[model samples]
Target: MTDDNKIVIRERSTPSKLRYASQKLIEMHDQLIDRGVDKQRATLIGIALHLESMAQAAESSAGPNLTPGFVNEPGSTSELLPAEILAAIDVPPYLSTACDTALRVEPADVPDATGWARLLHARCRLNNKFTGAPCPCTCHGREA
Candidate 1:
């Protein structure tokens, strides 16, 4: 597909939505572990889900003009959802931590059962989804 065809119109995520999504992630992780699922798979799922939520929340919170490449409907930026500023402030740190954790992993070892390994993989995927960065999704950023 051409670049135009590949373009996705993303909606900004609100702070309330972010919190709701985070809660959902915590629940998802707890349930997966509780259900005797593989820790690796469960962590991957949980992290992906959390990242998805974060993305949506970001869409809501990002100003219509936050990125120059995409177009936003007129007035969308000013008419933001009425959410607490403190809640909105969480996005940067949340994304930062997720990205940092993601960057440190070995793609091959990411699917391992160690703490947050699978989560790191999932975060990398989300990073690509959001920023269109070159993510191999194989957990091998160091070698590349």
Candidate 2:
């Protein structure tokens, strides 16, 4: 078949990290139910699974518009869902605290290493800020 007439199907080479984590939670829930663990434990896992699904949906809807910074910006989506989900699942306090701490970091505090700069660079490229070339931002070492 000619290239224009041939059909093609492309699939993701691997599931997203969040999807894998959700699958693991499902496996844990199944194991708990099969082993006759307490109903409350299984119920908590179910809640976690639901929360993961919600997060996935939100992420999908946000798509390329999602910014990668702390939830400090007004009108931006809160980055605390992961921490809240951890708390709901009754994980150790330290783990939840760590999640909260990580999400609360200010991008300006670590501009070079933070996702905020990468996102800005991407926007710059998309806007052809450098004449249809990669952004010359210092974040990527171009000295702009």
- For each candidate, the alpha-carbon lDDT, in order, equals 0.47, 0.41
Clash number for each model: 10, 0
What's the CA RMSD for each of the models? 13.9, 18.9
lDDT of 2 by residue, 1-144 (tens): 245643222232122544554565666667776897755553445444544544555565555434444322222335434545545563321212222333444244652234333333332222121122223334345444
Q: Candidate 1 on 1-144: residue-level lDDT in tens? A: 344633222345455555555556566666767897765555545655665655554664464534554433221333333457535554331233344565565344543434565555544433332322343334544422
lDDT of 1: 0.47
TM-score of each: 0.34, 0.27
Residue 138 shift from truth in candidate 1, angstroms: 7.0
Evaluate model 1: give its TM-score: 0.34
Per-residue lDDT, model 2, residue 132, is 26
